[model samples]
Target: MHDPERFGAAGPAAPTAVAAGCTSTPRRLHHHDQQAYVWSRVHVNPSPSGVPGEAAQSLVPPPRSGAASVVVQDKLYVFGGYGGGTGRLDDFYAFDFRTCSWEEVQVLSEEKPGCRENNGVVVLSARDQSIILFGGYNGHRWLNDLWKFDIATQRWICLEESSPDMVNAMVNEEDETNAAGMGMPQQVVNASTTSQRPSCRFGYVSVVYDNKLVLWGGFDGQRWLNDMYVYDFGSSLWSQVQQCGTLPSIRSCPASAAEGKYLYIQGGYDGLERKEDFFVCSLDTYTWTQMPNLGRTPSPRYFHSCVMHSNKLFMYGGYSGSQRLGDMFAYDFETNHWSEVDCSSGDSPGGRSSLIAQVHENNLYIFAGYNGQTVLNDMYKCRLRPIGIPSPSLLNDFRRLINDPETADVCFLVEGREVHAHKAILAARSQYFRAMLFNGHMRESSDNSPVEIRDVSHPVFCKVLEYLYTDTVCDATLEVGIHLMVASELFMLDRLKSICEDLIRGEISTENVINILVASHQHNALGLKEIALDFILQHLSDAKIQGGLTELKSEPDLLIEILKLSSLQPVTPFARRLGNATQHQVLSPGTEQQPSQAQQVRLFNAHPAPQEQQPLWRVDWR
Candidate 1:
């Protein structure tokens, strides 16, 4: 920067600018991809320092409002605010959203100011990392002092001496590329009685745009303000700008969110009534233009939180005339429309006003504020959701429609249990039902009466009906799957048959292979029958040892089929491996059979082979 005239050279009479080894580098920040705000921070030591601002401060911060907070690199820095009953506080705390906890950062040097509210705190990218602070209120009076907290040193440098020098030190300081990043010995200052400096005021609005510190609008005890002030770093002066368009009246505590060159202002009280109007001010032309309400405009309120993300402004939780509100709304600048943000599902900050909300990495971090009854020190994070899904009750409502007698046109008697059902759904799912009902094959179709369903129990019938409505199987088991397979095969429901086949295949083991194979043969289920034979072939030796041979001996036809296959192959040794370990045998206490290795007999058990399962339904007739 070309600030050598204002910052580089200084005489002994001046507040000399000496270079330090501390410099903060600027980072490229984007806000599209944001993760959920899950983690919180915690202070390791809860003992109070017993100092004026430290007394009674535990792990949790003191209840306060009007705190100065800024978000940087997923961490929020909260400075002193007016704690309702506890007086003004000077405690500096940090809440790291990544860690999901808080840690009190005690300033080691005694040069720091006491606690106050409505102060301006912004991140500075000077050679040394520093947080810039401006005016605030400390209960009894207004404060116009400027302070600089050296991040590395953890010391506060009070800048109450000269306004011109402070302005130059802030907007004019150059990045010290030659020195190690730290602090300068001192900064030179010039007197500012020439042009009018900002008056002593609290409840002001401050924002950093293009490295320029802009301060405007505050409650100056005597009157609310509508004037604007901009600080020029190079010129080192505070100049009041003229406005051309319609402007908002004198008001304090309005929400100001910066997006590009425009600052969006929304809702604040004006001594008499709260406001729901919105406005935008251009920093380029210093013009104020009220934004037209095109969306669901919020009720008139004050002390709410507003943040800009993805071309949208989010406003949440504030106080109206009669009561506090927990609702949140989003206004899209491009669409010029408003929509409500549904924070009803997760943990919301809930009806709070006079709190601090900052946007970082697409997530909104809101800090403690006054929630009507008392002050708060809690932090709540909310992830931005882009899509909506059906609620749990919606699924239940669909299931209830099946049992509604007025909606249901057919009935079923399965295992002596009468069940109400919809003919349209049943006919749509099964060919048997469609043929019997729509084709007039059953007499019960004309009468709309319960028809007996043979070989199907009430529970299985209920599960089949549930799948028709929801396409999900609840609490599935082997016994229920076997029954469902039979019922599905009988009704010619291919989808249900496939689901039951998959279920039965998952339960196929040496102990149950025989039963599954016999059931598949009885029901003529080709898929299940194929999978069961493949299981027996892979563990041919184990299949015999597990009683598959005993079942095969009872069926001469099946035995002849196996013998014919064995004749073509000659040796079905299942050469891959058996119950014994083929590699390094680590003998443990128990002797359990190794069932995992007996997958298939690869003629060549190579080191890297394709993991393919053999099919069981490969039958041939000559």
Candidate 2:
């Protein structure tokens, strides 16, 4: 039997929340002990040129939250946001993250862009160069003007059409707080572009991918857009790519990053709901694919920031539906896994959203953001290190088992491939394996020799062994999960079968419902079958709109199964007759009973396979 304590499998033990932000003076010896731990970490707070190393310094720009920040040549430039004294002041300031100092450079340009927050700022040139600033919101209206900042000259220049210059719009920090959605009408001019500029939007997702700035999924004043526009610096033109496959919903404030030839999008808010789904678009195909996360992950959030460094995607703070968050997570592209990050000890930026995180020299420079209530203008640096925080790595151990298995008494050679496993673990996890290995059932081969398994392919059999060791399917896809479900059913491993069932259920739609229903029925997965039927019936309108029911009559097996289930029970007034039409099924509702189609599907009793009919697993291979 698997020992819960030995495997640390009872439940995940939550780790201690690490500290961040600036802090001085050790309050207690306990805190001093934490400080000692901090020094061991890579996080370092460098002092100003003249100040002492341990001194608390001042590096204040204007106190404005929701502003956009960018790093150009080790100098951090912050753009305009909601200023208290002035109504959306347009100002530019720069700070040095390394030295912890601020410099409000003089804007030499005669005209400058107006104030805004969550502006899409990207480094056009990283070699001591310039940054491209795009549309954002002021207190009242969203601005679509684009501006470019020259690091050497310390001036602002309009990259797009000119707007009303706001060079003198500086707030004294002595007036009432400016409300969002206040002020100017920020009129948008028709840009001279091949594909037309993206609509004036805020909370949009933009990132640099394949030498092109890709912008997609943002909210205009009236509606949200799911269109994608790409701006090429070399061509100085914008073109909207015809996005195909499963397009993400119309949303804003979703975090995205570009890696290799793929752009990954994380959580964002759709104005009405916060989404936690993860998706990726391939530059090769430009097709969108949604991938399921492996384990515990961050909750639904928006206004978060994603930065890619060393092929790993790091996530910073954002606002969930209920509150602002100060958590961090890292996603490994190679492993297709998500792991939450825990800092050792230091003052963190705390829970906030709409902030900017720029990675420079293996360190993250986090700038001001709004934490639901307060608009902050603090600068913090998170130095990445191998923080040996405590967490049971059962998956890691299982991975080791795959690479370097041990204590294997019996070997399974299926389809000319070898799979190693321990008899005790298999017996504890699978009943069929238990009966074949430990219940004194003799196979064609002797106990000391390798067993030649049949029927199942190596990939499917590998998933079975994976479940026996790790209780998970390493690489679960729709096809793989279905095959595993079949193997799980044959092996009498109900829990493993349920894992596959749940994964299959998550992807059930009009296109795949019929196939899943067939698998469920064929494998005797009664629960999955009911769930699939209910999904189709519950969301019948969606299936019809998406053309999922177009093939309803084409499948003879599915038709027979539905009719068989209906024929097994007497039709009542609430129960309607399932009429197979050439195009659509019209439920013949009796006058005495008018149940909805969803309710009617639920009324069909799909009894569990009888105990006697369940496979006896009594294989007599001669």
Candidate 3:
């Protein structure tokens, strides 16, 4: 039950006494059970009488069940519920609270536990966010197994016990030795300790209490249980506690609700009789006490659904006798009473039983259940207004990038345009850009006259225009790496410069070394030159010098430039190597000489090196 005051409902004036022989309610209950009972003052039914009846007539099909369900990061996950003719269901679905929609999620493998029903499922209360599923009826057999589904990885892992045989198998796989060769006894001991696990059980209700899982009553074929078990997730161990006071009789399908430190059980059938009596178990004291006089209590029912939302317990459709119910009600634990709610407007699902209900981001989700005869597949959402901050928009732009990679290029294009314009303006104001354009010319041809100039295109000419108009650099290939690197360096964009450097470095194959050296020289980038020289020196050892010389002889001028730059460096290992090579005249002997008229004429007439070399410089970096 919920606190009435929290929902603006008037509460009971005083705490009512329980029936005789009942112990005092635990102190934690006072926080949720202290308000006045105000059932008569509030209207439970908001809709007209005919609304639910009409909605029932328009019932849509529901997804199959015996499936596992859990919520993480405000999204509802429904995985592998029983389907194939009510036997076993391997289908997976997810509900987005923000969109009020449902989507099927695909698993990596087709292998799944056969059709199952009444399985115990609980979301791990850990930061890694996995959901645990335990024993249930898989059509043919009663399953006593444990499996976990990692929401992020979308994979299922079977949890196995640490037996000697299993330990030995793991050890053999990890170690390359036999029993006599086993390294240390403590190694096996440590392995056993880390592998210790919990026994598997299904059809149980598991709720988080003080961050531990408190598991209660579930059928295990041989018998129904009234026993209670606690699982410490941190320690991976299970312990049973001796609880005092009258406990709820052994039953399955009871709606269990948890708020703060107490677990509430209500409205389950005990094979022979349908029950209306409810009980609250305190985690702090390990005791159970009957809740008194739930005024206007829901009819004797089982397989009904109850979920805690904003401290109020909401009860939805379930079976009663031979009939299915569509009515919805709210139980106020604070006032020790129940009231009906009118769900007339918007959308309302028809009567459903064994349906799954979970709360995510203040919204309640009701998933697949049977309405007496038909299994429902449709999904419904109940919206709850938040208390403090306003609802946040679910459409985050950055998340859109991960979900839809195709849109990334378009998004980057738009953003890049703005960034490029800003960078161009900054480049216009700096000396770095001046150095790149030194002794170069950029002429707009009005007439076919060969233009001669030193550093044409003033920074101011394009700077203001690009800054105001947002001009984007469309050609962002390796060809543009040198230009972009120049601009990036001028604008102090180290990240962009690093990206350009990486692109240039990746293009430094032996065939492209001459082009790379020319670009590095044009931009006056010592870093780019160092990268090219190191690559050539590392790969071009004495064994490969014969093949490298053929390519180098064609670019004698470039080789001369490299030798001149190498000579200016202080004596380091690289300088010593370069000096030795220069002294030996590793390049063509006449490269440093003033050529004769015949050789000069041959150089002027030299066909621009192979087309392969020209296009090699234009390869796309990305």
Candidate 4:
């Protein structure tokens, strides 16, 4: 839940208004003492040396709003926007996450789009690596031009131009403020056009899906629109979509995101009112379904920035009409719930609107926007973390019940030592125990006398009993792990056997690698055997000092494996770079000694190329 005291100026008030070329002094929201923060601002290094870990600062893009930006290959490419005194801008800049630095993208083409703001932009295709632009305000009139910018070529190509009839209609308008109240040179599109493209407009939401641009809802100079359109990139055609179901009301500047087959729309102004209602549209069915106003609903707002990450929809600061809101909220698709993200910690991007927010990897970035007082040049970042309480672990509960005399319905006599155990737990955990205690004609099942286990030692049996109860083994050395692996195989507990194999593999050293290899081969621990072979191959010299070669020489089969593996290892550039020059050397008992044909057949009969298998526990056995 969110803290209400954090929102300043109390109850709803009249919406604030401001003029161009001047700052509107909107006060910052009050800070609260939150338990945990979900958002943290990234402090970039601004030093001339570009050294990291200095005092936190940013060398970023200039302050601007209504910019068109898109992320490609870990780089954020920002295009034109209104840069205050610089008026409308056509300059391009990119912020590289790898270097944590900004660079101006040099345009190679002479033909380019003029200075503009409030344009729609999206990545056309991953294969082509280009940005598609459409419809924006160029300070004087509304634009319906369609352009494409190739990131690799640093070139722009105009695909389509604005209809002259529509341009003339806005130019000859009587009331210049037709788009109304939100600023810029608003004009009504009183005259309709027979053009094959969408009419001149800006502030519409655009999403790329299936190589098509899906655009919905914006001001068309005359009135707020609720129409939907699809532009096919392959065919270069625009078509108005016939939508079904309860459609969203006419609105503009709503925070939106698209994932899979659905597009989500939330909170925007409808000319007369700001909305808090949320809606989703399916690209497949072309249907709009209003999402239930459940959980912690955000206040009515518009011009906010929204992004999708890890199946979550995140929204940041925006104007709530009455005041600018700094609060952030996330809607989870899996749970269908909304939760307020705590940003009270770190440097929060306090209360701003018209900001450009984008997500790359695990970080959410917000660039310049109007903070009421001024257009910000500063940039902020938040490292996204997983939300909700983790499911509780049952390890401790089961551990406490192990060998409890009160709950012991059965007992085991192993190596002349009494180990109390629950029959239900043992039977439920192991197939061997289930058959022995419940199904077979074993004397221990009929009588209440303890079952005699002569094969396993007492300590190994105790560890096995603990694993039956908790499905885990702890504080096990390499010796104990090998015994546990044998016990697991005997009881047919594949998961426990895999865990034991992992324990043995993790404790492998040049001194212990030969021992692990011997145990793995003896117990059919194939994955662990592969890891040991690779370890011995990588550190042959160190292992040889510990009688590693003597042990393998005694076992002719093991010696053949080492020689065959070493002979097969290719000395690639990567291997050479890692200084593994001896990867191709076949170190045998003697210089000329090699495995015979019968020994080669025996080695081939075993698992092929065990070194290729991963060291992790195999899921196939489970």
Candidate 5:
């Protein structure tokens, strides 16, 4: 799938080992009849500009075998490796390409489940990125613990072991949801049964395929293995696929790279023999095919590192029998061939094995590994240049113009609504600055014209835009939501306006009814008041509003304000009935009451009843 000879050593050299720090002497190339592939050497130091040093406190030391590594979001993550005195580590570390540094990441609730080496690690692109680690050998006993690491929330979880009862339960669940409504139990039962399952193996080659992890060739204590198995993450189930067609007879330490639907396996030892032969397996067809012999392949090696970059596969230093090599090789997938490149110019490290190599940003990063006698703790970046160019400037007159007060008054309409162009223009310009910093493309100016406005703009809209850019919620009160709503409305941002409206709607839960009422009235957010009134009327009786009315009556100015809001609104019939009941008061018969109807008739002729009848009516009924 990937070219296997993309970064190898090119020129010919009789087998020789240069001392550490000595420049690799470039040997003259033979004039072959075939076209020559010229390679230029550029030596990169072990410690690049951003890479952390071995002595750095944050730098994680390279662990011995039995480690698990994965790449997520351009960062390489290493977890749970064995170190001599440290035993089995449950710690996690991440290497950032941007920072070129290794930082220790604490895996919350980490438990030293077991010490293991040569474990099978496969990164599953499921549930926010997780690495699944299976079966590894501890010092004495072999392990079958299946642990998963979540990248988003740095944590490790061990999967529960599956049993026959669990399998039966799963099968039963599947049967109820079967297609064709067959309601057949035997079909489900037959599918659950499996034979020739891969014995728990360590140091296996595991790769992701069709959302399943396909594992092949590993050691199982007694012998090296070539058995293949597929683990489905969704089902938490393992099934052994038929090992088809002349598999690489039982082997270990094979390098693997997956491209398209085919997995290419190369160079590993088969107990009695060191092999250089390579094979390709079609995951879709479940068939293995041997690749045609490429002239002058890398010497037979095991435990070498292989990484796919830009469809080209790069192989780095590893052990060939007793010798540890620092040579690099690249393979061309189109021609199914290997080519050696000139990597000696860059500050190449000494020969090593058991190293880890990962590709990021078109560069190969090689971490610490064993250099025959001792374990080394150095990191190197191999810079591969497809082409070169000069860096361009990011800042210019246009950026300064947007920030200047003279030009800041320019108004623009993003979605047919007028807004101050300064903030939006500046934000768009900032992205260009970032691109330039990251060595990305320069920003190009657009021809769109700014919207001209005659009125003084609202400062709140500017504040809201500032919050959007910086994520700074200056005012977390209801006012902020109101301001956001106004800005969204003015800018015609329906989504943003909806979000603000939602927040405004949520404010109805506030305990202070008066504040809610005032905010709702000011913002014309009647929806909020409806919710507030619903709560108030349900929990507080007429006594509460009456008390408020009484207090308002004591203060004339406040009463005027209260009366403004108390005007006729759509109240329920029950509330109107309650108001009528509270308004009428019967007077005591003995107490001196208002003038009789006769006196009102003599004074202003307002009464229709006779004087005698009025006095009788006024008498105490009791």
Candidate 6:
């Protein structure tokens, strides 16, 4: 492992970058030819104070848009962008995640790229330890320059000078290749045979993979672009990439993020209008496939920002056609579903576009954007929760089967309504259905007649079918939970019974504790019964006031158990009197003298007023 101290500098003003140290010994970041063993990936290093953006409030970058951002050595570096009325900015800034502070980068080299916005920036490799920048608008004109900023030397070297006739040269080459080749498009042939640089463009998407920069879709000064190009860092050559499958539309300022061998692009402006389409390009075959728009997709917008973290693409605020948007959405590649994020959980940055976002240690940090009214330099950080393999229903692809009459073979006539269900699914999920339907015991199983369910209501039976098919229930209530618990017991769905038991347990209180205890005992809900019994034992004083003594007395076994359990624990004076009086009437304790009904009334009348007390578990005898 390389020492983090190697990147640290001595001065206060100069950029002091460090590779946030880990608790354990650091491992090789990348596996080269000499590297033999693979190292386990570690979580992103958290701030020393354990609070992100706490120290970043005072020192922040000036408001701007279309800036380029790249994360290196646990630090985020942001370059030039349009600074609203301040014009374009060429200043560079770096935020140290470890220190939670922003520092202006002091360039040692006098020569550097001019002020620009919407540029492409990436880190080619850890060994190079440099930032690669290319192509942007420089206020005066479009630029096609390539510059490398060395982190160790703190200097910028111009690898390729700004080209004035870059577009014309590329056009001439394409024309010649087409004229020489047979009636086929020569773009694909020239892509392999000829080496050429892309014309000057802004708002293009660029990502680094296998040490090569993949550039696609941007706006040249004249028109919107929809071409793909690759820059090999090893050969230092540029080549056009011929793609297959449905191509993404010609657009600019689209949100793009790269993961593994796939590049995901979504929402951009196509000169005519903004688009909300989604597409993915395979880096291996250069194939583009449009993903179906599914579930809570963001509106058509451009100049948005996206970052890939833990197999999910998080897209944040952008410019709609009419105004700026502040919404956040996440797209799951595994399930092909989009979900809106709850931005109200934290300090939201509000509506903005062209912001620079980078993921560090599972936290997404966005900085500098145009919010329609003004450019903003405020930085907002929100920790990202990994979008796991959706819910079980989505994972198993069975949720759609619920209440789908077209595919259902059995219909249950429940409480004056017909509830459709599949016999195969019901039989497979519950033993009650298997015996009643397939064992030749019921007439409804062999015939087309609907099965009559008299005991269960329509809503309750529907919840049962939902669990039978999808393995879960939605929006269960206290009333429904008690009825569902009874239905679950009748249907022999233990998992469903447990789920209902848990639901009813959460609703346990003095008002319903005894009733719940009686229902649990009647329905054989052992878990709920134990919990309810404990509740009554703990709150014996208040439970007595809830007036379930008649129900408690009905279940003589339950009442005796409550009395026996209460005898071993510390009790309030009122509880001791009640238990003793009830025990005398119920058990008739071995001819021992016991308080009569009238005497018990006198005993209660003579006792002191009930004082506020803790629950049985928390009660202190001393």
**Every candidate's lDDT:** 0.64, 0.63, 0.53, 0.71, 0.55, 0.73
Lowest-scoring 10 consecutive residues by lDDT in candidate 3? 38-47
In model 6, the runs with Cα more than 4 Å from the true position are: 1-58, 167-195, 386-622
Residue 450, candidate 5: C-alpha displacement in angstroms: 25
TM-score of each predicted structure versus truth:
0.53, 0.49, 0.46, 0.53, 0.49, 0.51
- Model 6 lDDT at residue 358: 86
For candidate 2, report its TM-score: 0.49
Q: 14 in model 5: Cα distance from truth in Å?
A: 32
Sort order, TM-score high to low? 4, 1, 6, 5, 2, 3
Q: lDDT of candidate 2?
A: 0.63
C-alpha RMSD of each candidate structure in angstroms: 23.8, 27.7, 29.0, 24.5, 30.3, 20.1
Candidate 2, run of 10 with poorest lDDT: 613-622
Indicate whether candidate 3 or candidate 4 has the larger TM-score: 4
Highest lDDT against the true fold, candidate: 6
List residue ranges in candidate 2 displaced over 4 A.
1-57, 84-89, 162-195, 387-622
Sort the predicted structures by lDDT, highest score first: 6, 4, 1, 2, 5, 3
For model 3, how does the per-residue alpha-carbon lDDT over 513-534 read when each residue is reduced to its tens digit? 6456555656666666677676
| lDDT per residue as tens, model 4, 255-309 | 8888788999999877787889999998998899998777898989987889998
- Clashes in each model (backbone N, CA, C under 3 Å)? 23, 14, 23, 1, 24, 0
Q: Ten-residue segment with the worst summed lDDT in candidate 1?
A: 11-20
